[model samples]
Each structure stands twice: as structure tokens, then as C-alpha cells.
Target: MSAITLGAVRPRFRPRRISPARWGLYAFILITALYFLLPLYVMIVTSLKPMAEIRQGHLLALPASPSLAAWVKAWTSACTGLTCEGIRTGFFNSLRILLPSVVISIVVGSLTGYALSLWRVRGANILFGAMMIVAFIPYQVFIYPLVRVFSFTGLGQSLATIVTIHTIFGLPTMTLLFRNYFASLPVELFKAARIDGAGFYQIYARIMMPMATPMIVVAVILQTTGIWNDFILGLVFAGRDNLPMTVQLNNIVNSTQGERAYNVDMAATLLTALLPLVIYFGSGRWFVRGIAAGAVKG
Candidate 1:
């Protein structure tokens, strides 16, 4: 009862309402983030270190004087095999495959989505369902059959064949994405356009497609990453003369008898990852919004 002056009490300064489980969740996230970032940290540090340091096995030591020599070597002089011509030889090869693959995949995906979304074409739903079913299957399973088909069609191991292979592999997910997105859009828009004497392509191009920027961005992200990072498909379809940087990187990293330049290997890996990382960073605002979530939900 001494000095018992409980006026307003200040609510006992109640601790902010964060449970132990929530705290644990945050702790888990922080550890997980550190775990993922470890590789990047190692690479950056190692890339800055000279080959001398790399050979000395100081994997995490800070460089005494940071240099871009490793990066330069990776760009213009490192050898995949005997030739020290660097990874630049196939830079054009990747671009040749990457550009056409991205463009054609988007076009085919957009068309397929538009058709499946708007038109009541016969067997359309069945075909779409089949596509969805096939989407879940690992692409490796399709490679043998497709390789045989392409080889027979005389498109074997060419850029065009690689592009087609990407489109085929990309079809299901791309179609599903756009179809679901279009389905989420108001049907009245398409109906009104139809009533105004607009044809399918007209409505699609002039009206609906304009509103599909988000979905398209999402599709671009998926296709760019998948097709760009694609080693196996590019390896099997892109042929000897057209081996992508990924294939070159594999050769550099995996050459058994040849001395592995870990520093250059790290730099090369970072370089190879730059494109997809660019796409992700560029469209980062909309990239966070899951493409199909709450899209059409009432």
C-alpha cells in the first residue's frame, strides 16, 4: 500500500504481441537467408582473390588487393578445354537461341491462351486439359521422343530446333498461365467486343492483350529463366557449334584432367546468372505478385 498511486497504470507496458513461434519463424528465415547468401558471398570473395590465393585454399579470405582479372579471364581468355578463347565465343550462340525462343514462346503461349480462354472451339478444353496434365511431367521424359522427332525432321541440333524445343517445353505452363489470367478477366469485355463486330484477333490484340501486361511479365520471367539457364535442352538441341555458355561453364568446371580455375568458375557462374537476375530485378515490382493468385477470385 506504500505509494499506491495507480492512476492510468500505463497498461503494464505490454510487450508487443509476437509469439515464440513467430520469433522462431523469423529466426528460421534469417538463418535460411544466410544459408542461401553463403554461396554468393563465397563467390564474390573468391572472385576478388587472385588465382594464387585460390590455389592456397583460402576460400573465404579477404583479398589484399581486389582485381577484376578473374572476371576478365572468364570473359575473354579462360579455356573450356585446350583453347583459352574464353566464354565469349558462345555469347552469340546463346543470344541466337535465347531471343527467338523467348519471342516464339510468348507468341505461341499468348495465342494458345487466347484461344483456350475466349473461343469455344471443339476439343479445346480437352486439349487444354491434356496440356495441363502434361505440365506436371518432368521435361527429361519428353527429351528422348522430341530428340528423335527433331532428328528425323532434319532440324537436329540447330538454333531453330532449340527454339521449337523451348516452345514445346514451355507451352503447358505458358498456356495455363495466360488462360487462367484471361479467364479471370471480366467476360463482359470480350462479349461486348464481340457484339461490336470485333473478331477474335481484333479483340485480343486491341483490347484483352493490352490488359495482360502483368501476366506477360510473369511469362517472360519463367521462359527467360528456363530457356536461358537450359543446359540439357540446349546441349541436346543446340549442337556442338551452338553450345551455350552453360555448356561451356560445365566443361570448365568439370574438365577432369584439366586444372579447374575456381576463381574463373565462380565469375563464370555469376556471369551466366546475370540475365535471369536482370529480368527478375527489372520486373521486380510485379514479379512479387504471384501471376494467378486472387486474379479472378470473387
Candidate 2:
């Protein structure tokens, strides 16, 4: 009986050999990670080094004496244009544009998606088709016409114009995202809400919106990244005062009048990218969960 009981308890640990194929896959993954990480590593190291040390030509070496002066200068006094006021101005402008554009685009897109998905609106199919087409068309095609219309209406090159431009461009994709998500939801939920005397807006506001938290997160991430990184649109529509961080970074990097401050340029580029990076990494799990939760299903 003792021997039988001992045999019934299986061994807790076993050594398993990795196959050659598995080893090759691991090597490939490591190589891929290094390929992407090398540039970022160089950027970080370079940003910490002084110009004298950087000029010594050790591109991949750690800085002999690391400092934040470059970062400070990049944030406070790096010449972006005729002004030496740094990228902080553009940072603030980006924030202003990002918040309003994200909120308005997500709200309007989600509502339009909800209406088309559940409600029996006339010409819904045609509207959806047209929007999908617009989504695929290059936005460059509409730039001239949109400029003409906005200028004709006396709304050219301002915060409002930029926000409106972001919202309009974002609508088709936003609507598609929310519409697919809404369509994937159980039909019984909508049916039950209607049976319980919930009006269209009531059902949408209380039930639908509450259940759309995941999609909303996805939309926020996408819009925040897109609007913050927008250079062309900002250059064309954001006016001089409302130029975004990307535009400022371009100016900092491309200022040909003086010797290129590589360290400052690296720091400014990282600064311009930091917000999107933070948002993406902080909410990466939620982004995956949102995508998995029927973001593409229809």
C-alpha cells in the first residue's frame, strides 16, 4: 500500500529538452527585439552625452559623464523657429488639440455607430458605405478642398479648425470600430432594453455606453496618438500659434542655420514621442483586451 501511494504521486519536476526548431525561434525573437531596441538605446545614450564627447565618434558607447542639460535645454530653450522658446509651447498646443479631438471624435463616432448598428435609420447602409470609402481614400486628396471650405467659411488655421479636421478624419474609422463592436454584442440585450420601455437615447446612454468602455479606450488611444503626432494637418490647419509638438520637433531637427545639436535633437524627438509612448505602454493590456473584445467583429 505504501509503494502504491508513492507511485500514484507523480514527480513534480521534469527536465524537457528544447528542440532545434524551438531554439531557432527563440534566437529569431531575440534578434528581432535587439533590432528594434538598438536605435532607442543609441538615442538614450546619445541624449545623455555632451557635444564634445559625442563628437569623439563612439556612437554606441555609454556616455563618459551623463547629464540632463540637453533635456533641459530641449524642453526650455531649444530654438524651434524664429523663437527660442523651446517645444513647451507646442506641447501645450498638442494637449489642447488632443483633449478636444479625442473626446468629440469618440463621442460622435460612437453615437453614429450605435445608431447605425441598432436603430432602423433610413439610408444607413449607404451612409456606412460612403464612410468606409472615405476612410480608405487618402486624406491628402481632401486637403485642398477642406482648406478652401474652411477658408471660405473664415475658419482657417486655428485651434477650432484643427480640432474639426481631426474629428472629420477620425469619424469613419471611429464609427467603423464602434459599429463593429456594437454589432458583435448580443442582440438580446438591445431587445430586452426596448421591451423594458427604454427609449433610443435612453438605451444608448445607459446601457450601450456603459458596455462600450473597452471600445472607448481603444478609440482614445488611437485618437490621442494620431492627433498628437499629426504634423501635416497641424502645419496646414493648426495655425502658427497652435503648431503641435511634432511640427516643433521638425523645426528643431531641420534648423539648418546652425550646427546640428544631435543630443538636443534626440531629446526633443523623445519628448515629442513620450506622451504617446506612455499612454500606449501604460494601457497596453487594456488595448489588447479591447481589441479582443470584438473591436473587429461584425
Best by TM-score: 2
- Each prediction's RMSD over C-alphas, in Å, is 9.3, 8.1
TM-score of 1: 0.86
Alpha-carbon runs more than 4 Å astray in model 2: 1-15, 288-298
Residue 235 Cα positional deviation in candidate 1, in Å, after optimal superposition: 0.7
Worst 10 residues of 1 by lDDT: 289-298
Clashing pairs in 2: none
Q: Give the TM-score of candidate 2.
A: 0.89
State in Å the error of residue 174, model 2: 0.9
How displaced is residue 92 in candidate 1, in Å? 2.7
lDDT of 1 at 190: 90
C-alpha RMSD of candidate 1: 9.3
Alpha-carbon local distance difference test for all models? 0.79, 0.86
